[model samples]
Target: MKIATILGTRPEIIKMAPIIDEISKRNIDQIVLHTGQHYDEEMSDTFFRDLDIRTPDYNIQVGSGTHGKQTGLMMKGIEKVLLDEKPDIVLVQGDTNAVLAGALVASKLHIAIGHVEAGLRSFDMTMPEEINRRAADVCSTMYFIPTAESAINLLAEGYSRKNLFITGNTVVDACFRHLKIAKKRGIKEKSLKELNIDKMDNILTLTMHRAENVDVKERVVGIIEALKELDDADIIFPIHPRTKNTLEKFGLFDELNNLEHVHIIKPLGYLDFLLLTSASTLILTDSGGLQEEAITLSVPSLTLRYNTERPETVTAGGNILVGSDREAIVSNARKILDNKNFADKMKNAINPYGQGDSAKLTVDAIEDYHARGLLDIVAPEDIMNSFKRKMKNIREDISVKDFERKENALVHMVFDGKNMQFPTDELNLNGMVINYDKRE
Candidate 1:
């Protein structure tokens, strides 16, 4: 069966790389579609080369815009590609606008959708990613969830268990697969030399690009102030293009740049970034993916956000939500950086993501479900049976006399173009009467 994998942005590429490689190994027909949500070469093209991902078969180039405009353009572009490709299933990873657009178009076209990293909820209606995640999950036919907690989230939302597969997370697979390659290529050493950072120096990798944080001048200023307070560790800030623009706009770029400890660098390739994260003493970011990566690398992280979609990281004892409050951010960072016992405790926390075979499990589940004809958006046998039982309960709850007494009530009903008579007497009612007794 043919598959269309839709992805946009750096995180989606990093997470989907292993699954793409897996499909290639199995000789499956797969089409890679890029929406160009991240238009910058550093954010998009470099990931493909870094991860050894095949070049995208189609690039919509829908670039940055208002959320509505971006999603609309993506839907229009993705619709055209999906119609031309007409693949058996469309696969989308993460909660970018590309995922939402791909899922919507595929759902309308009656193509099965497989959602990777499904069942995430921040429960904050204000966050755009939360909306995208919920919408994508609603349109999906198959859910490749990352953890048991994610499965719980979906089950609570009334999704079918049959369609949910606990495939750990592909990020775990990507990190494990690439870290070895990064070391083999000596990317870590090269990155350290390029940044002029000695191996013995404490490194705090900072990444903040979420709109909620950077759009507000006060919040951005507060974060920069917190970075200033953390003078002991050298901060390696791989600045996103948008974040950099915002910093410049707010007139805080020079102030942050002048700080001796904060080293603001442009975005690095995925391999180089992976190496940097692996070597970091601590991580501070608002990125959900970085929360996962920090834990995977055994690095303690302070999330510069009020809430997180990846609460598992916090629960696993490797991350903390410090928000944009200057005081909170500084206190948390100092606690991790100054206390060796606390740092080691976080570094030794068990990785909750999985054993890095999630790609195999995900692809295998897709093939298994497809072969069993379970990928289509049709009711499964179990659901049909439950529906039948509910219908039977409704039928038994109504009395023939009560039905006959109603104005324009009928003694028969048509089902599947067949007329079926209602029970007219006690004998015909079978055992449906709730209180009927033979002695009476």
Candidate 2:
């Protein structure tokens, strides 16, 4: 069985590394597709090299554009590839234009769609990612939810229980894998020494790339003011390309650069950033991945966003949502810095994400589904037991029998803003009508 894995952003690359590693180990014929959502080599190519991942088989080079333009171009590009390769399954991770486009095009071709990080919801529809994830879930044939809460979210959204699996977050697997590599390479020690900073110092790791935060001038200024309040602490910020552009556009780059304690540097590779995150005293960011990583490492964190898709981290006492309100941001930072007891409590808190075996479970699920198609290979019942035994934490009621054979179905799709009506009896490729305009 051929598997097509589609990715675009750095976050997607980081999250998908372990799954790619597992697929390679199994000698699966997998193809990697790059959408170029982050087209810069520093942001994209560095990740593949750092993670030791094979170069992408196809690079559409969609790069950056408006939401509609990006997704539209990606959909067109991915559809041609799907037609050429005709893979049995197309896998996409997280909520990006790439995932949405992959899901859309594969659904049109009746290819099996597997969403790696399915069922995540910040419940804030204003965020583009929320819409992308929800829409992708609707078209997915396999849903690999990272937590029980995520599974519950999918079920509540009326997804088929048979399609869902509660594999832990693959970030845990990637973090564990990369952190070991980082330690072996002495990355953390070397990074601190190079930066002229000590590991024991009060360090605030900041990352802000969310469009909602940086795109708005008022919000960006507020965040800067809040950062100024923590001028006494060492701030290590791995500036995202978009964030840097937005800062410059808003005329706040000079102010931020002049901040004595704020050390703004170009984006780091996965190992460097992971090492930096591991050694930080506190993490302040708008990134969802960082929130989870901070929780895994037991570091105190403050999220600049008003809401998070990963609320488990906050409930576990590892992260606080401070938004971009200057007072709130400053207050929370001061609270975490001044209250040693609070920081210690956050450090000791249990990570709700999970221990690192998510990649193995994900690959096992994929292989089990593929093997089910060959009657000459193994009995379905035995395959089910083997999968269950291998992945002990799998839901008790989920069985290998849940895997469905794929065939074309009638689809209702909207091109542009209009719903195109076709003869009802002529249902063929992916019976579901996809409303692309719903995102617009």
Candidate 3:
């Protein structure tokens, strides 16, 4: 069977690397598609080179845009390639717009979708990632969950146990694999020299690029103020391009740059960053992948967010949630930096993600599922009929107004052999009536 892996951002590339490499080793036809969500050479191309990932088969340059525009463009681009290649299954990793678009397109075309890091929920609908992940999960045919907790989440959500496999996170696989390469290449010494750091001790690696934290000026100022307080530690911030643009927009780039201890460098390649992560005494960031990496590397981390989707790290005691509050950030950083016992406790916490063999497990699960005929695509008509039956059951409990509200909120689209059909007429609660209009 053929597999088409869709990835966009740098994190997706890093996490999907091991799985892609594994697919290459097996007797499977694999296609890699890049959405170019991260367009810069530093952010995108450098990572492929660092991880030794083969050049993507397709790169639709759907660069930065508003969420709607970006996702739409990705859907259009991905659908074209998928239709041309007609792969049996489409694999998507993280909850980026690319994942959402890839899953939606694959589902519409009746191709199986395998969500690699499925069943992650931050529960905050305001975060676009939460929505993207949930939507992708709904559209997925196979869920390759990372942890037991994630599996429980899927079970609670009524996902079939047969399709849910707790294949430990592939980030573990990528981390160990790339770190070995980095060590062999002496990346640690090279990175330290490049960053002008004489010692790796007391290093605080900072990375904050979440839209929630960086978009708000108040939050950005608060985080920077907290960083200013921690002058004792060397802050090696490989700044994300978006965060840099936002800082410069708010006139805080120069202020952050001028800070004595904070080193605002361009985004590092995966190997270099992995080396830095391994060497850091403490990490401060709002990234989900970094939280898992921190636990894997036995480093203490402070998550600068109100809540995280990767609560495993926090529960395992490897990471702490300090949010964007200046005091909380400062207090936590100091605790990890000054108190050796506390730092040791965090460093010695169990890595809940998994052992480094997750890629093997993930690929093995996929191959097994396919052999068992569990990855077959459900027909669109069957899917719609099933959805309609569920909606009919829901119609029994809700008021007519509530039903109408819910139905209107949904984009009622169905494929009709040659064209797509969207319901234009309002359906009453008594019975459903869908009027189709040809868009073309």
Candidate 4:
């Protein structure tokens, strides 16, 4: 089966690397498409190179712009490609404009859509990513939920159980795999040497690029003030280009430059950043990906955002919601520095994301669907309603609670041409496969 994997941002590239690698191993026909949402080589190309991802077959070159303008441009560009390629499935990850555009265009063109990292909601409509993710979920034929919580959220939203699969988050796969590669390559010592920093006992890492925190003068200044208060350890601040531009626009760049004990560096490549994060005493960021990454690395993190969709990290004590408040950020940093027991406790907490086999599970699900001729199913109104009815009957037969908790449960349903059968009681504990004897 032909698959079009669409991605734009660095996080999507990193998270999708494992799935792409798995697809290659299976000898599937795959096309990598880059939307160019993030145009900078440092932000985009470096990740693909470090991760050894295949070069994209098509690049839309839709760089930074207003949300409406960017999404509109991506839609136009992506639609053209979909018309030409006509792949069996278009796979997108996370909530970037590229994911939304790809899902929308694929849905309109009668192609199947798969949304990886699906069923995440911060419940804040004001955040553009929240809108993108919700819309993508609505358009997708298959929802690959990252966690059980995400699966519950999607089911609560009336999503069909047949379409929902609890494939764990791919970030765990990326972090675990890339960290091993970085260690073997001796990137840790190289990064420290290039940055002119010693291999210190304690290093505080900072990465803040979200517009909510950096675009406003007061917020940016407040975060700098908070970082200034963190004087007990060596602080490494990797300044994103957008954050640098915002700082300059706000006239706070000079103030940030004047701060001692803070080593302000340019944004790091994937390997260097991985090495730095793995060695950090504590991490402070507004990035959603970093929250999960810290959990995998066993590094304590202080989230600069007020709310996070990845609350499992917070529950695991691997992260704290400090927001942009100076006092809160400083206090949280101090807690990590002073309370070693608390830090150790957080480091040992369960990482709820998943093991590093997410990519394998995702690919296995895809292969299963393709081999069963389910990848051609379009998520039109009547078709979706039928799937929903099937799900409801299944729920009645076996409670949703039990189904979700059952580790060995097999979902059995058959589709032939445009027709489907929901024989809810056909298969028992013998693990028989649901046969689709007829196909058009």
lDDT of each: 0.82, 0.78, 0.82, 0.80
Clashes of each: 0, 6, 0, 0
Q: How many backbone clashes does candidate 1 have?
A: 0
lDDT of each residue in 1-440, candidate 1, tens digit only: 99899988888888998999999999999999999988876556655776678989999999899999999999999999999988989999989899999999999998999999999889999988889999999999999988767776876575755577888889898899888878777654344458755464799999998989999999998998898899989999888888999989999999999999888887777777887888889999998998999998899999998888899888899999999999999988888888999999999888878889999999999899889977666644643323211112134434545533542232322122232322332223323422211110
Clashes by residue pair, model 4: none
The C-alpha RMSD in Å for every predicted model, in order, reads 11.0, 11.2, 10.9, 7.1
Best by TM-score: 4
> In terms of lDDT, which candidate is stronger, 3 or 4?
3
Query: Candidate 4, which segments miss by more than 4 Å at Cα?
Result: 43-47, 186-198, 378-440
If the candidates were sorted by their TM-score against the true structure, best first, what order would they fall in?
Answer: 4, 1, 3, 2
Q: lDDT tens string, model 3, 142-194?
A: 88888866776775576655577778888888888888888787654344557
Q: Identify the runs in model 1 with alpha carbons over 4 angstroms from their true place.
A: 43-47, 187-192, 379-440
> Candidate 2 or 4, higher lDDT?
4
Q: Give the clashing residue pairs of candidate 2, or none.
A: 409-428, 409-430, 409-431, 410-427, 410-431, 412-433
Ten contiguous residues with the weakest lDDT in model 2: 403-412
Give residue 338's error in model 4 in angstroms.
1.4
Query: What is the lDDT ranking, best to worst?
Result: 3, 1, 4, 2
Off by over 4 Å in 3: 43-47, 187-192, 249-251, 379-440
* Candidate 2 local lDDT, 219-242, one digit each (tens): 999999998989878998888877
